[model samples]
Target: MITSRLMVLRRAVCVSWLSSCVRKQNYCSSAKKTRVREALTSLDSGSSIRIQGWVRSVRLQKNNLFLHVSDGSSLHPLQVVASSDLNTRGLTFGCAVDITGSLEKSPSHKQRVELQAQKIEVVGECNPVDFPFKIKGHHSLEYIRQFPHLRCRTNVFSSLLRIRSEATAAIHNFFRDNDFVQIHTPVITSNDCEGAGELFQVEPAGNEHSLDEENPHFFSVPSYLTVSGQLHLEVMAGAFPAVYTFGPTFRAENSQSRRHLAEFYMVEAEISFIQSLEELMKVMEELFKASTEHLLSHCAEDVELFHKYNSPAHREQVNLMLKRSFNVISYTEAIEILNHSSEQFTFKPEWGCDLQTEHEKFLVKHCGNVPVFVTDYPYDLKPFYARDNEDQPRHTAAAVDLLVPSVGELCGGSLREERLELLKTRLARTGLDSTYAWYLQLREFGSVPHGGFGMGFERYLQCVLGVDNIKDTIPFARFSHSCPL
Candidate 1:
């Protein structure tokens, strides 16, 4: 009797071991399936595939389920159909899941393809009660702004971000193909590039209270966040002939507008051995075209979304923009056009004054709505670094502002003043100290006529994606009075 009992116990143990081995094999096989994109392209309809992604939306039916999953590549969602026994009781929105299924072309007219899921495993769970995006209604921008961490999971935000990444890559590829060496410029500097007095002051460690004490401050010299990388790139251009810097730049202005940001990304390029301002304009045109064409070709889904949901006028404008060559108008001509216009502007266009946002919009909207390079601004209105045109009026400089539809001032460039004496005189007249001795030394030693401009990365993203707010262009935005997650 004892021997028979021992035999029964051993057999039961062997059965349990076999069951565990089978379960392990099943898990390993599921892990080795192809990605969603690959599965969709393959001609085999019954091929086994597995995909893992965050749950975008979940529709629960009495006998089955429908889920939209996004793995963060394209804007299109992967449709997943699950059976009733998938154990989805604890699953909620934004939950991560692994699904093993057969890839099938869509039978319904709406979907392109569908995944008939055989097994669904819950990789992670999200609590619906605590989640901010659980409701099935459109959330206001202000309310959605509170959840920056989870906001990217939304359809609109995700689409905008995908376009932003594509546009940035396109910009870099354009510079690389044109023999421009990428340079890293300093973020903290003593000199102001824009000369606009809108820089954010950077306080040194242990000197936080020095300003209050009023003893000339025990600080290691005050430094401020750089508003532009133009000066630094100019110095580099003298050595490298052609170079560009793409990085973060900060401004301290408190204006609350759709176009302004406290901190933003800038792309500054300076090229030496350039003959005239026309060459600079050509480079700007090529950069704009390259970036726009890249996004339009590669990001079809995102572009479609922009056309559908964004302003109706925007689609027509974008189509018209790419159809023809951009127009070139001098600052004087732009003033004339604006002055003659039947539409009234708040700040009327004048020859000596800077182009306000309203004037830029009018020029783009009426004048073919294509990118325009408005050149020859009043030197006094521009930075001290811009090269003054000897042939033009007294304060006029050889500067150009690249204006696009819905995005004003995409790029700003000029022929830099390379003469040492003239630069020094301009700096002194502008009341800026000659503290940057090295920068001035470049002009003194072996300077050539060099010119460059800074393009805001977020601004380019806004134009490419047709997004209105600059805050949504970046993953983690730091704007005035707003920094959520």
Candidate 2:
């Protein structure tokens, strides 16, 4: 009887709270809150609306106060006109304001509509002196990158972020449309996807230097951050015909260059029943064209800003890439072209040596400045899992790399060795047979010829937007000696 009475009292209290909320919501609906982007495009004139945003610019005319405000809804800001008396000392650039106004057609030729403010409230104030960004200042990418916390307030970084978000969704949709399964690969792993040994080992905060002393090594053995999710995706490919993983991949690379980051995102996909590199290249080409097309169609204004301001030549390059089919050449042919070219290279291209950035850029230019697939790399240059071509004098693996004009080596992939005997011999030669015992077991159980490719998400953004620095493509950069929150 006591429990039933308490339940009735709780129901009455909930009803009272909901009724109060509904009353407040209906009252606030008088000046319907609207985003700048929605208001600019959809809302009709002569509608009462409320807008909240930071001040981008403040103009004082003879009798009127004009302020341009943005809520990061779009690249353009909404123009607000008010009486000069409404302007106060607290109203400054970078200051936040809540505005209730009537939308009206503008007399000026610049914009189609403008906001006529009836009341303005200064919700947040900015001194403008302490702010890293200046109003109407043209800051370079490097200059704005210093203030990571406040960089999104700038025009360039903000647009890049919006484009990045759209590109991410587009890639996922591309996979889903093609019947590919998405897998969430782990950040912590017992295996090194790449045997380069540049891994960021993880452990408890206090036991940084405990390296195999007596703590049982945390995970029983040393575990490190994954440099690539390809191996994990390969495991999923055994269960599903097509699978992909997109997530942050960490490496201990000590690079501060425009194209390298210690922590970056990768889009990796694996497909079963593919015996040739051509099948893999087809998917790579389709993904590039599809994702780029999506960005151009959906985020035209944001993408155009980069093409117009950053790289004027890239617009034509991108159009040509979409129109023409990508070029393909063997690794041996690429080396010959490099050796014969008159252009001086820092790292000389050789048949067995890995292709450097300079070499990759030259290859793309040699192939009419379009994306070129360089296939059949030397056996020694590839990782242990690459399928052996088994050619006589010149040994090579069935590996391929897709190199782009601006961004070299956009994607890398190979046909994985599915034969148990061949894989076992290769792993044993490298003294990693015991380490990869489970990987070898996959071949023994049931395996079909499969191939996959990994594309660097940052590099893809850099290519599409003509961004010179890879750091500018990602929201937060993690490089050597630097990790800003």
Candidate 3:
């Protein structure tokens, strides 16, 4: 759903390790430094501090030289005041600077404190004529996207990166708090977990041995980038009570849609001894609520930038989601609701057909635009591992999908077919029985009833931020052919 320019910005300190390397150092190396966020909250007026960051704006008055500097510690920048004589040719917007100043109370009501500069030096020079981002105006997300290498310098994307970083930490904290063992699943695998045929086949870079179709494979068999970690988590489920994995996943999908991406992250969790879809849905719902609450509390300022500017109406939508309990409806009832709706859908609603994007959106809207769980899908629509519902007249699978207002399907999961005979019979229909012999073995020995769901990480970000495009949610977007540095 999203990749970003600030590839691995640590939420712990806003910028952390990268701030030291992001810009050139052209000032004193003796004095200790203070992050912009740390200085902003300091109550000691007259305390000496040095800050290094890109100059956001510069104002040269008759005697006073004011500069706004930010090191990505927070959404706001620190205001600096100096003598006009201290301002030089290099003190311009987008230029990185290091300044030693004393913290003092600000006369302006906009901020609590301002820096009274003792000395200022331009560490990294940036030409105003060539800088993609200007000093006086805000750039659109689309305009900034063309320059992925420098998008992090912009206020909009920087705030987004900070929020993304905190959201990641919050998720980790949630799973750890719930006693879910964090499992690092493999990125490359021999099995196609989604079975969608959208796998990105992997191979060596060079033909050292002059390999071909009949020759030996790299792993002696076909392998591709993982589409999901659910199957691997299931294997862990056999030995552990609960396990979760959060990592990148890939799909060789040929599209440039706003909601699609070639690579994204997923949070997959598997729980042993899970009996029904209700228990699985409870976990999913709780995760969402917990993560969102954490974001609202920790990333209030950063999130406000989106709620107040990017998507003004999203603030109310988020409140509604947290206030109301998610509604539940069966697949049959969802089809009935779609059939009775006045809106005409391109893919007509039917009994066994999978729900299209339009249908999913309509269902969410019908449920008062809150998150809704639609369960008990047709047997054929679900994957091979979906436990049989055993309703003879209308066969269905114990599967469920959590659909949000903007994002059609944020998560999908189902109870695995733990019965050895049923799983073997299902795999036999497609001649995959032998290929999945190890998977069958998981059920054979000490297999307990288990279920898990994988939520698209980027989609979750998009859903909360009300970001229109999935690309904006991520840092460096990887699509069909556009992979930026």
Candidate 4:
């Protein structure tokens, strides 16, 4: 009987040990939890929750300590309140911390709810002196640009990231909804799409000296970082009725203007069986309107931050852009408007010359600061692939450029030269017939009159946000004589 009692005691001890282990495991699992965004939205009062994020601000009061924490989910940070009795060690601006707290109604009007902390654990410590962002009132976009690595921690850059992500999603959705297949185009190519002589040559590693030797270069013939994806989209359009590509493009031009970037993104779309420039312009207009609408609806708060801090004029521009349809005018009419303008232009408006930024800005203003599509540019000003208009007085191409306020040209597109004879003749004149034989084959097999356009992604952001520089729109700014990480 005594031995039986002892066995029962041992079994009871084993059960207790197992229960203890389970409790510890549960505690450990629940410790590293809760996003600041979710914590801010909690409606259950007096519920214990754990939140983790980088501390945006810390305010110590006589009885309580308040911290503004953010996990990048929203533009605004969550308010975390801890009692003076709680350990506040290692909690500072930019320091990552995990706090176990209770949900409570906020006394202040800034936020709906705040965290009443019972425990605070420092996940990572940051030195306030070494941190570049010291929680200032308002930082200029130019000043924050100096610290690319840590700029995302700020409110403005973080908002831009959110806007960019939403805009990308909206672009994909617009294409998908309209039955346009997203095609991945090759970044390296043998022919320059623009034929501008601004190609960045790509050579094989350890063979830098053999560029001119002609001893089996990296690609047999020379290859370059693609300046545009229009040709590839053109190729795909032949197969698929509608195709588009959004990817990085490179240029070797030494332009240092606010609107220029050596490496940037382009959104190109090609539609087969297109008859006139009107059809292509319709697609471009719909795309711009749809994407901008999506951004304004979804990222209203984040986009407003750009207007409030960056440029107050941006608010009116955005409202106008949304309220009205884009304006359309012929290239000839645009030039005439510029020529008739009272304001003196640095580059005089001429018949055959390319429209400079000054001219584009003037045209946009003349149209009451609305986005304008100027169609039928001079044939000589466009590339060899642009379809010839074959007009009476002036030779022009079936090309169009979308110009916006603040930014000169946001998009450029043309109806492709699909006639085999016309394409061959143009290529022969440009001396690119042999190099672009494959392009000719597409016309030979199944020729359909098609057109496409390329929109500079950075310039689009600048136009929508009224940002002054193209660099501020992109995550990493790359330009002439400047490449910073």
Candidate 1 lDDT over 1-485, as tens digits, reads 00000000011111001111112223221221123222224335665656667787889899879887766655656778888887776567888887778767666665656778887877889887788886376754455667788887777677777787778788899999999999988988877777778887876566555555444433456778888878888877877989998889998877778788888899889999886889988888788878888888877677777667664456677766677787888888888899889987899777788899999989987777788888888878787778878886555888999898897878888998887888888777766645766767887778888888878888877776677877767878787787565
Candidate 3 residue pairs in backbone clash: 2-474, 3-474, 3-475, 3-476, 4-475, 4-476, 5-475
lDDT of 4 by residue, 14-47 (tens): 1001111112213221221133222223235665
lDDT of each: 0.74, 0.83, 0.84, 0.82
lDDT of 3 by residue, 1-485 (tens): 01011111222322211233222223222222244223223235675667778888988888998888888766778788998877566888999888887767778776666778888889999999988888877788888889888999998999899889989999999999999999999999999887788999888887685576676678889899999999999999988999999999999999998888999999999999989899999999999999999999888878988988889989899989998999999999999999999998999999999998899999999999999999999999988899999964689999999999888999999999999999999999967898899999998899999999999999999999998889998888999989867
| TM-score, predicted candidate 1 vs. hidden true structure | 0.85
Q: What is the TM-score of each candidate against the true structure?
A: 0.85, 0.90, 0.91, 0.89
CA lDDT of 458 in candidate 2?
Answer: 98
Q: Candidate 4: misplaced stretches above 4 Å? A: 1-43, 207-214
Top candidate on lDDT is: 3
Against the correct fold, how does model 2 do in TM-score? 0.90
Q: Which ten-residue region of model 3 has the weakest summed lDDT?
A: 1-10
RMSD of each: 9.9, 8.8, 5.7, 9.9
Clashing pairs in 4: none
Q: Compare candidates 1 and 3 on TM-score and give the better one.
A: 3
lDDT, candidate 2, 108-223, per-residue tens? 76766677888899999998999888887888888988988888988788889989988998999899999999999999998988899999998767766555657557788888
Give the C-alpha miss distance for residue 197 in model 3, angstroms.
0.5
Of 2 and 3, the candidate ahead on lDDT is 3
Better of 1 and 2 by lDDT: 2
